[model samples]
Target: MLIVCHPVLYSAVVILRMVDRKLSEIAYSIRESFHDSGYTEIFPPAFLKSDKVDGFRFIYRNKIFVLEPDITLRLMNRHITENSKIYYISQQSDEYLNESLKAGSEIMGGDEDETNIEILRMAIKILDNLGIKNYNIDISLTGIFDSYVRKKDGQHLIRAVKSRNYPQIQDMEIDDKDKLLQIMDTRTRKSGIDKLDSIIERIDDPRIIIDLGTVRQPEYYNGLIFEIYGKQEFLGGGGNYIMKNLRGCGFSLDLQALSKLYHGSHERVEK
Candidate 1:
């Protein structure tokens, strides 16, 4: 029998096991939260048809197969029943992406604003359970920048804005780059519906900040968009989108990255 006695390798394996256990604990707690909210977990097909998403592809029997880089497309089809609230935690594969788990949910058959509010609230609840206090959810209306951006060159402007690179934006052919810059400077604003603000206001959570600037790709998102962050890392992001003409919104959590929040203390993680 070959002997295997590498102490360094053994320690690395132990560390991986510890982190894995903590990640499971976090996922379980968050799953219960979803269940309490009437969302049943689902396992989506490993591959699906949609030209909207980019992922690794292979040909089998002359048919094209690909993995989803973004889980948002899983609900792109309007097969979801009205009044069905669903969540899924499954492996997601994409071009250039290795090892990722996404926990997401979609609320169908509800009022549009209500869906936005519910999904945003649930996103907060998930992050809360994970003990990520130094975080905020930046909310923005999709297509708010439509008037200023040309359909042909909007993606480039969006990338510059997303990176907060003002110089790059100014160099673009756009006549009014300042208009886009102003959106990036925002911290908060009131939507016509005070009720949505009412829910978030009382939580006394400092993590919520409204962003009026983030560019929403009309093809991807149509209404309210939100992203969750811990310090500077993007833990999750989702928003309202029209898929197959069906209006809906949802969020997806990065389960693997969430383990970094535990900081190696199992006792605190168990808490």
Candidate 2:
């Protein structure tokens, strides 16, 4: 059977090819950055037999597979091979055929402070490689949540912080209200990191702001939390987290978003 193609369909095919070429270049550039930074790239198993993950389970060949949401949880498991530094690029299908392409790096099997610095530095280098300078890494922590989470209306407060909903935080009757707002204040991040560290001057610096208020709901984030932003849009981000008993740090880049931004198709970001 011969299929007819409209001029509009031909145009759409051309646009897709252009977009695919751009994406390939971006992926290669980012991967090279990871390699230059001493990170070994790995294609982690897409399906795992154990551990809780965000994906649904399905049986294949009489065996069940749990689709992986991310790699942080696998690092500390005794069964998983531990490495010095690593990164990966992969995607998971959503409810649609198109998948979100992701690329990120991690500092595993390393000192706590050293891991933190290396990951943050790498985050900056990634932004630089992408020509994204108008950005800030909003930093926060789990301890703040661990202590204040038990307070009245705790869940609401967390939502406010994660969404940056100031009115919700202001209206809450919790005792930590004022303190939470103060933490959300970006102006205090430098001083806050300093307060969290005695030798801030000695460390490699990145543009940072501290929002010690609410946090992203991830079981892995039992330590430092951060989100990278270019103005209001999130470029990419991650944090110091515990994968079981071992402490590690890593970040994931939103490859699709960067492509959209670079292509001046930012309006389609939601689509």
Candidate 3:
């Protein structure tokens, strides 16, 4: 009778039950959001061909998950029509592998909000729904779009990471606008930026301030760039990059660190 009572079986059953419950809750929330927003739930393949992404370590095996050859290829290969708005929901494995030889999976999804600003705004909305406020947000806008719209307004191509807790975000106290100007002019004339500059400078807009500064990830950034800070420390950053002639910007939220700033009570994990 004692042999029949296996500890591993009990523990595994409990874990599976907990996981199933969590998945149910997550699915319910997602379904509710999609139903309210007129979005249909979508499913993407768990395994894909790995591609060269900055800071990503992709593994190739008998099974290869790689980046699609081209954006056109992705669109062409998709089963759905192009005009359809997609709401992909799936467990995605990150290129980052753990010691257990398993890739970290996250409940990842994105809505095509169109512009970078709109995307950031949507992200903020999601955070707000979680009762998260008083956090810094990072946004990245492409220079092409920024140069066009920024002529009317100075804001463009900015990456903002939002966090409720103020990290070491300190203003460098850069009083000299001329210094910023010089950096801009010099960098604009450089190889890749020079081309982007020509397209941007063609438009005559006095409101636009073309400032120059280096971001943390150089390989990822091409044209315009910006970041947000809290308490003078960089909580998050991102930049615009032109790939396949499509300009896009993105940012990441440091949730682990941000949790420290939450005013709400914390619940301990059950062992």
Each model's TM-score?
Answer: 0.87, 0.80, 0.41
What is the Å distance of residue 181 in model 2 from its true position? 2.2
Supply the TM-score for candidate 2. 0.80
lDDT of 2 by residue, 1-271 (tens): 9989899999999999888977887788788888888778777666566535555566778876666545554444334344458888887543233467788877765776667767887878876776666777766666776556677777776777788888877777877566767766644525545533422344435467556653666666766667777766777778877665556778887887777555422422444
lDDT of 3 by residue, 96-122 (tens): 531111110111122233333333343
Q: Model 3 TM-score?
A: 0.41
Number of clashing pairs, model 1? 1
Ranked by lDDT, the better of candidates 1 and 2 is 1
Which portions of model 1 show Cα errors greater than 4 Å? 1-4, 50-52, 189-204, 216-218, 263-265, 269-271
The model with the greatest TM-score is: 1
Q: State the local distance difference test value for candidate 3.
A: 0.36
- For candidate 2, give the lDDT of residue 38: 78
| Distance from true location, Cα of 168 in model 2, Å | 3.4
Residue ranges of candidate 3 with Cα displaced over 4 Å:
1-23, 50-84, 99-114, 142-271
Q: Model 3: how far is 238 from its true place, Å?
A: 8.0
Winner on lDDT (2 vs 3): 2
**Deviation from native of the Cα of residue 47 in model 1, angstroms:** 1.0
How accurate locally, in lDDT, is each candidate?
A: 0.73, 0.67, 0.36
